[model samples]
Target: MISKTTIDQVYETARLEEVIGDFVQLKKSGSNFKGLSPFSDERTPSFMVSPVKQIWKDFSSGKGGNVVAFLMEHEHFTYPEAIRYLAKKYNIEIEETEQSDEQKEQANERESMYLVSEYARKYFSEILWESEPGKAIGLTYFKERGFTDDTIRKFGLGYGLDQWDAFTQTALDKGYQLEFLEKTGLTIVKEQTTGEPRKFDRFKGRVLFPIHSMSGRVLGFGGRILTNDKKAAKYLNSPESEIYHKSKVLYGIYFAKQAIAKEDNCYLVEGYTDVIQMYQRGVENVVASSGTALTPEQIRLINRLTKNITVLFDGDAAGLRASLRGIDLILEQGMNVKVCTFPEGEDPDSFSKNNSYEDLVLYLDENAKDFIQFKTSLLAQEAANDPIKRADTVRDIVNSISKIPDRIKKEIYIQECAKIMEISEEVLYDTLAQIDKKGFAEASKKIKQEQKAFEVVKNDQVVEKVDVQYELERKIIEMLLLYGNLKQEFEDLVLKENEEGELVLEPEKIEAKVYEKVYLDLQEDEIELTNTQFRTIYYKLIEDLNEREEFTVNTFIANLNQEMVSEVSSILMEEERYVLHDWERKEIYPKEKGQGIAQLVGETILTLRCNLIKTRIQKLQKGTEGNNGDNSEVLEEIVNYLQLNKLLNAKLNRVLS
Candidate 1:
């Protein structure tokens, strides 16, 4: 368990915007920040961060809470993991007790795999630096690649021993479970007919590169073979475990996320070394596909940090053709892409190794071309002196162009392609229209087929009836959170006999604190919140407001359980997202909460009283109908309750039948 002092320090020191901004690109919007929803695939931003409250809310997903909540939701981290992540990011020393063997056995499967992978990373790094074979081969290979000792250690590059079962035996001897080792692909285990199972290292005789999540947790490793083995694959990755998916993981995202966001662009490469070499050369905003095909999940990872991606291609023309399909996927996500090919026979690793930082950056800037232009020029050369191939080339470029979501950008690219292909814009536009029509037809056919196969039910329109008691309870909590400690003059209603010998409410002015008024009013009527969650929060909120000289939403929420924390955040941030639109600038002024908080509080309590009286009247009416004897008494009680409900509603300016 982390010490309470350290947890509190982490919460105080970690800024919500700064922590979330490391993963999502946040742009300033008035008092808060807005960015694309990381939880959902969105073109516009619906994720909001409020620095004043030290909380964030994803309007799309309806997930809102403090900094710790955001981390847990986004990264799938447990509560302790989130705190430790924040502590590390802010450089706060975390005081934690070591877990015993019993406690370790109780950990969940995914967490166990993560622990095993992390342990493997440390063990491999030690071997690379300490063991003779590792020093002779793995360390020497990294050194020859021009990687410094700091870089090697920074990435946690390590070596897997050549002997079978060397790593497996060491891990088992240390009490690390063999089940997790097999799950994380650290040790390969095969069941045997004999009493003992056969086991060996998965990355034996290979140099290891640990892959990390966005928060720097070790997910798995990528290994490269050192010696010649024609039968074996050149490179191997950790198997598809619960924690690591190769297609979704980038090579160096954990290291490059900050630089990518800062530069507002990401450099895309094809291998782990390409990323390391470029980063080691001072070009820090670079990541790789890890020798796999580009995936939408991977593209989204980069999209969170930057919209512009500059794909660094080697001089292999055949490989370039194979990579072009991935560029269309990027365009489909509404990202800007550019292509930069190195000189003949040079890749990102070889080129960066040979050039200085300045020269490398200059070379990239000079050679980077728009994806459309690169695709057009490269294909047009192959279509030379052939009209049929030329027509196919035109359609292919248009197809790529149509994948873009923005209509204006599409039109602009069409005109640009027209000029380059020496064809009129009309021809390209015609081809694009035909392609769109075919796509729409195919989509409609699929929808029709699905509808025919399954029975489709359409829901009737629901008439939304307001929940009077629930809303009143929620409003009471909101007011207490917002203005409970403030002192104000209130119009106190006193029920007294009027000149006509009837009960009437007469207004009397009195000065009192907001919480005091609410508490006294509820006590006088003995009204309690009907909603369970609201009732729990109501008492705690009042207690905190009464005791503390100062109140902050973040601190108040910190004391509540996870469920209450989410409720408080939702109540507080309900109207905050609308601020992103700047309604005042559009000539629509909203009523300020600060101006009439006292009236709002009184009206809320009045509404609650009216609802309770109505409920009493309902119960009296039902009792009178159900009973045959002494019905007159119940009728009189119902009449009195109706009169009180009418009087309260009148004061609230509510029209009732």
Candidate 2:
């Protein structure tokens, strides 16, 4: 267990914005920061971060919590893992007591797989640096590729020995489970005809590249065989397991995130060497697809750090054709994409090796082309001779343009296409509109099918009830947030009269405070707001009001979690969007809506408190007038009720006036 002191230090030192900004590109939105949702695909940003409140919320997914919660959700880290990660990021030392064997045995299988993968990574890296075979094979292979010692170590490159069962035997000796080894594809298990277990090393005689998840957990490995064995595959990758999914994983992203964000663009390449070579040459903002076609999931991963992607492809014709589909996928995500090809007979690895860092940077800058223009020009030359092919090429480019989610970007690309193809803009626009209509129709059909399926499992009445409650809660919360601090004067009773004739009633001055009354009334019912955003804001308001200080809207809003701030802001402003016509505007003064909202909120609070006081007064009067109880305590209670009622009435009257 980590010491509580160290956990507190980590939480205190880890700034919410700094921690989250490492994953998402956030731009200032009012007092908070807003960015595209990492959990969902959307063009407009719905993810918010509040530095002041130390929390984040994704409006799209309805997931919002403190910084620790974000890491737990996004990175799939356990509570302790999230804490330890934050500690490492903030440079805090973790003090942990050792776990007993029984406790270790109870750990989950996924965690065990993670432990085994980490152990394997360390073992391979050690072999590469410390053993003779590793030095001669793995070290030499990287050195031959022009990789420096620092680059080799930074990427955790390693070599597996040529001897079969060498890794498996060593792992078994070290108490790591053979089951995990087989499950992670590090060891191969062959079941005999007799149903016996037989184990052997999976990547024997190959150099190993450990693939890591975004949180720095090793999930799988990619191995490259050095020997010329025509029967064997040159490179073998770990199969999909419980943790690693190749389509969603981008190699070097764990290390490239900061540079990508800082530069506001990512340079995408094909292989591990490409990333290493670019990084070593001072172009640090680069990652690889790991020799796979780019996936929407992979593009979304890059989307988290930056909106701009520049794909670096080799000059080989096959390479260019193979990569164009991936560029189309990038365009489909509403991202800014540029394509750059190295000079003929070169790839990113070879080109960077042949030039200085400054020269490489300049070469990429000068050669980068926008996706539309690049695709158009590349295909136009081939289609020049045949009319059918020319029309088909135009349609192909239009299809790629149609994939864009943003209409403005599509329009801009359409105009550019017009200029490049020497065609009228009207024709292109008409074709795009038809394509968009077809796309929307197909989408609507899918939505209808989904809705029908959902309706079969849902109860309409229950949904209606929930909707009603949601609206009511939203209205009440809005009022509390907007006018909870407003104050008014009230009348309080002073002194009861002489024993002689009749009781005298004198008015004493009092201040009508809505916040105190509302807070106290809510407390009496013990009713808590069910909505997370509302509940967070409600508790915070109660805390602030209890401090007996004047409430500052800016200060209160500032202290809320980022998700709640955006939500609260949207709720407060959603209904105020319309501008009045001349006659309607004349009858309605500008400040009426503002004052009316405050008065309605204040009056509702006062009324609720007054009703409660009236009920208490009735009980007191009944106790005093009947012979059921002693009158003195009841009389004191009646006196308090009268005082409270007087205050409430005064506030209501002031508001009415």
Candidate 3:
């Protein structure tokens, strides 16, 4: 475990906006900084970072939390991992307690796989730099491709020995598990007739490139073969596994995220070398799909960093034609996409090496075309000779345009395409309408199928029901958050013997005491919140109330898990939005409705507690009336309930008047 002192220091020293600003371009908006939503594609800024509160909210996704929560959400770091990231960023030294061997063995499988991959990366990198064969072959190959030693090391380039089972033997000798090595696809396992495991190197005689997740955890590897053997593939990637999904992983993202966010744009390329060359040429905001056809998952990963993508292609006509489909997928996610092509004889790798950084930048800036215009020009020549091809190409482009989630962007693209293709805007709109109708029909069919499955589960009564007590608990929580500090004068009940020889009520001084009343009432009833989020908030409120300090919503939110933060923020903000709006406009006077709602929420909580208390009191009465009953606990609770009833009456009197 990390020392509490170290954790406190890390949290205290780390500025939320400073940490997040490194990965997002935030413009000041009033007291807060706003940027494009990192969790989704949006032209308008909906992601907000509040420096005063030390939290961020992505209004688009309803995700709001403190600095650690942002790292967990955006970079996919676990709780401890996020803390460690903050520690590293703020230059805090972390001292953790040593774990036993059994404790290490108890770590989660995914984390273990991550550790194994990281170890392999270091081992391969060391071999590449330190070994004679690795330096001569692998390091020389990278240098021949115009890669600097810094660039090579930055990408974790490495080499595997040519001898069979060399890596497997080394890994086993180092106490690494053979099973995980095979599972990660670093070492292949063969089963003989005797059912024994035979392990061998999977990327022997190839230079290695370690693939990393956004948080810098090694997920897999890509290897390039050295020899030109007819049977051997030129490039081999780690097979799909639990930790590494090829379609979702983009090469060089771990390095390019900050640059991409800073520039507010990302350059999409085809290969590893393309990414390296572009970065070396001072275009640092570039990443590669690593030769795979782009997947929606990969696009979403980039979407987290920037809303604009510029795809770079070589001047080879066939490759350009083949890659146009990926651009359509990007547009479907409502992202801005531009296309640029290099000279006929050059790719990004060759062009960047041959030209100065300024020339490359200038060339791209001058040649880049919006997706609509680029697609139109590319398809127009083929369509000129054939009317049928022209109509089909028009439909194809319209289909791509229809995939855009934003209607305004769709219309803009439609106008651009119509003007370029010499077609009427009305015609393009009509065609897009047909495509949308077909898509809606298919989507409706899928929804119906899902609903049928959901109905089966519903019929079985598998869904958990929210009880009345839960609602009451939530209402109480809301009131405590909003009106806990609001004070009012009220009549306090005091017992006295009157002339009639009976107990009588005398008025005494009292304050509203919202937090105290709620806490004492909950304690009297022994009612526990069943909802996890409500329970978390309730306990936190109790802690604050016990200290007699006003509850700070931001402070409470900062300490919660990201998932719980979203849940709590949604509950708090959903109700407050309309209330605050009405108050601001001065359209709704604070009269009966507002006061009545507050009173009702408070009363409902008291009623629930009172009923539960009364039931327990009855049980206690029965047990005491019988034999072997200890009523001390019950007596103490009854006395507490009487005091709570007095307090509740005091609060009710102020509301009633």
Candidate 4:
């Protein structure tokens, strides 16, 4: 367990925007920062970070919390892991108490797998630097490839020993479970006829590359075998597990995300070394697909950082034509993509190694071509001197163009295609329209199928009515969080019998803290928050506010359980979503929170009272209907509740029918 003092230091030192900005590209919007939602595939900026409150909310996915919660959600880190990550990032030394065996065993399966993979990374890295065979084989290979010692260590490059059980035996001896080893694909287990399980290392005799999530947790490993074994594959990757998904993991994202955001463009490459070489050579915003075809999940990872991708390709690779199809996927995500190829005899790995950093940078800049220009020129050469093939080439380019989501961008590309193909804009536009029509028809079919399935489920469910009381209770909590510590003047309504013998509400002005006024009003009415979550949070919030000399939303939220934290954040951030739209600029000003804090508090209390009184009146009327006699007192009570409800509603400016 982490010490309380260390945890407090982390919370105080780590800035929410600075931590989240490493994962998502954040741009300033008013007092907060806005970025694409990392939790969902969103083109619009719905993820918000408030440096003032030290909290973030992703409106698209409805996930919001403090910095710690964001790490737990985004990186799948446990609470301790998140704390430790922050401690590392902010240079805070963690003071810890030793864990008991029971405590160690209590870790979940996913965490166990992560621990095992991380151990494997460390073990292999040690072997590379310390072991004789590792130094001779793996270290030599990397050095020969022109990687410096700092680059190798920075990426956690390692090598598994040639012996089959070297890693498996060591992990077992260290008390790590064989179950986790097998799950993480570090040790392959086989059962023998004699009932003993056979276990061996998965990446034996191979140099290892650790694949990390955006937050630098070791998700899995990609291994390349050094020996000339014709029977074995040259490269192997860790099998998918609960913690690691290859399609969603990029090779160097942990290292490249900051640079990618800073540069506003990502360099996409084909393999691990291509990324390392380019990133090592001062081109920092580079990542690789790790020899896999591009996936939407992978693209979405990059989409969080930037909207532009530049794909680097080897000149002599035979799959150049096949790779062009992947560029369309990038375009479909509404991202700008450019293609750059090295000179005839080289790939990114060899080219970066051979050339100086300045030359490599210059070469990329000079050769990079827009997808439209590159595809048209490459295909046009093949279709030259044949009108039939020429027409097919034009259609192919237009098909790629049809994938763009933006209407203006689509029109612009169409015009550009017309110029490049020496064809009329009308013809290309007609092709784009035909493609879109077919696509829309297919999409409509899928939606109808999905709707039918949804209707079946929907029919079996009960539709819940809106809970007005819950909303009122939630509003009170919001007000408490927003203005609990501020002193304000309030209009307290006193219900008294006027001279005409009718109960009437008289406004009395009073000065008090907002929380004090709210507390007094609710206490006088004997109104309790009926919702269990609100009821639990209300007393705790009130206690914290009264005892502390100051109130901070982030600190208060940090002390609550996740469910209550979510509720408080949902209440507080409900108004933040609308901040994106500047209504004042359009001559439509919305009520500011600070300007109406006192009225808002008074109105929320009034609405809750009205709702409660209305409920009481209904119960009385129901009781009168059931009973045949002695209903006069209940009738009088209902009438009194009705009068009180009317007055409360009047104060709230709500018409009662």
Tens-digit lDDT track of model 2 for 1-657: 777688667766788888888888888764577788889998777787767556576767767667776886788877678889998888888999877799778777877788888888999999999999999999999999999999988888898899878888999999998889888889999988897678888889999999987768898999999999999899999889887899999998888999999999999999988998999999999999999989999999999889999999898877576678998899888899999988889999999888999999999999999998789988898798788988888888898999988888988999999999988989888888888899999999999988888646445454333444355457666666666666745454444665784345565655656566566546765655567767777778768766747664445654564466656655654332222122345675344344554346545554655655676688767666747656777688788778657755775674322
Tens-digit lDDT string for candidate 4 (1-657): 898899888988999999999999898988889999999887878888889988888889898889889898999888899999999999999999889899887899999998999999999999999999999999999999999999999999999999989999999999999999999999999999997899989999999999999999899999999989999899999999999899898999999999999999999998999999988899999999999999999999999999999999899857888999889999988899999988898999999988899999899899999999999998999899999999999999999989988999889989998999899999888888899999999999999999888546656788799999989888888888888999998888887999999888998999999889888888987888999999988888899889998888877887887777767777877777767665667887677678778888887787777778878888878877857788888888888788788777877777877
- Candidate 1 stretches with Cα past 4 Å from truth are 97-105, 450-464, 581-586
In model 2, what is the error at residue 230, expressed in angstroms?
1.6
Two-way TM-score contest, 2 vs 4, winner:
4
lDDT of 3 by residue, 481-585 (tens): 655655644443456777987555576755666666667557765777777778888888767656756556665665666787766555554432333234647
What's the distance in Å from true for residue 120, model 2?
1.1
lDDT on C-alpha atoms for all candidate structures: 0.90, 0.79, 0.79, 0.90
Which 10 consecutive residues of model 1 have the lowest summed lDDT?
454-463
- How does model 4 score by TM-score? 0.97
Question: Candidate 1's residue-wise lDDT over 1-657, tens digit each?
Answer: 788889889887989999999889999887889888888888878888989988788888888889888888888888888999899888999998777889656778988888888889999999999999999999999999999999999999999999998898999999899999999989888899989899999999999999999989999999999889998889999999999998889989999999999999999999999999999999999999999999999999999999999999998787788899999999999999999999889999999999999999999999999998999999999999899999999999999998999999999999999999999999999999999899899999999998899765668656799988887888899898888889999999999998899999999998998999999999998987889999999899889888888977777888787778778888887777567667888998877667887798888888788778888888778777757687887788888888888888889888888
Clashing pairs in 4: none
Which one is best on TM-score?
4
Q: What shift in Å separates residue 374 of candidate 2 from its native position after superposition? A: 1.1
- Quote the positional error of residue 484 for candidate 2 in Å: 12
TM-score for all predictions?
0.97, 0.78, 0.80, 0.97
Q: Pick the candidate with the highest lDDT.
A: 1
Indicate the residue-level lDDT of 477 in model 4: 86
